[model samples]
Target: MIEKALQVFPKSYVYRNEELILEPRNNVYFRLVDVETEIDFKCKMFAWVSRPIAKSLNKYWAPRVLKSFNTLMDTNFTKSDMYLIYDRLGNDVNRKLTIRFIESGYDMELLKR
Candidate 1:
């Protein structure tokens, strides 16, 4: 299942470290920074798109999916200072989306599963 998900929506590694942190803001955005550089990358959530039928059929499902994504970030990340750009499209429909980095060298390739 994870392999198939990766094939559909590849996990883009924004940062790699022994301990990476992610913090979601009320504005629905996140900022990531290397603790050493003091420079940070800002990210914002765009849209939450799911399978058209599933989206239309269940109203609460989208939020649940998003919550799952948030949980994943919270559990996987080490610090809460970093912000995650929540792309529902990636989590829901398994579609890969672009994650713009405010700082350089932040974009990375996901580790092979």
Candidate 2:
């Protein structure tokens, strides 16, 4: 169970008193955290897509998703701070949505699963 948990989670245990610490220190755990977070974000997107809702879906999801992400990553992101920009140069753009993390500044990839 520890192997399975450590496989998906960045830190197996975090200790605190004098200072905060994460276990399994040799794994370069931050990258593991990032991978888990990206997968989670994609899963949420998939779940939201599969949900049977006829209402304005984007309207319902933006705040809810952003709030969850903020709490997970310890970031102060407001709905107003989020931006969706279209940079495709082709006129045949049929709504291709891609998240380029650091360049785009949309750090949903840092969210904890």
Candidate 3:
């Protein structure tokens, strides 16, 4: 999964050290550490789990994940530029989640775009 994510975001720039951390709880957290300033910004992800499916599974197995990426800009980059990148990453994550669920033999209807 990490390798696939890296493939989605293959380029590295000089601004920051970004890493994606996924927990067993199905929570995806992104930490962006600024290289020069030594500051870290966090982005949390929320996944949509249907109530019926949640009850059936007896756990919070996220079917559709919605990522709201945010970071305070103290750097040279514009807010619009940051948001563009954030949205792209979010879209990539969404695609990955969909593919993973499909491969696991779960009904795709549990996930909605």
Q: Compare candidates 1 and 2 on lDDT and give the better one.
A: 2
lDDT of 2 by residue, 2-112 (tens): 234333334544233211121233221122232345444333322232121112236655454445434443455564333221112111132222233323454544322
Model 1 per-residue lDDT at 78: 15
For model 1, give the 10-residue run with minimal summed lDDT: 20-29
The 10 consecutive residues of candidate 3 with the worst lDDT sum are 65-74
**Per-residue lDDT value at 95 in model 1:** 21
Q: Best candidate, lDDT-wise?
A: 2
Best-to-worst lDDT order = 2, 3, 1
- Which segments of model 2 are wrong by more than 4 Å? 1-57, 84-113
RMSD (Cα, Å) for all candidates, in order, is: 15.5, 14.0, 15.5
- Write one digit per residue (lDDT tens) for candidate 1, span 1-113: 12222232223222343222121221122223332322211122212222221233244443443444334322222111122322232232322333332232333223111
With a 3 Å backbone cut-off (N, CA, C), the pairs that clash in candidate 2 are: none
Q: Local error of candidate 3 at 86, Å?
A: 12
TM-score of each: 0.22, 0.27, 0.18
Give the per-residue lDDT of model 3 (tens digit) for 11-109.
Answer: 412233464543223434454442122111111221212211222223333222211121111123233333333343232445455445434443333
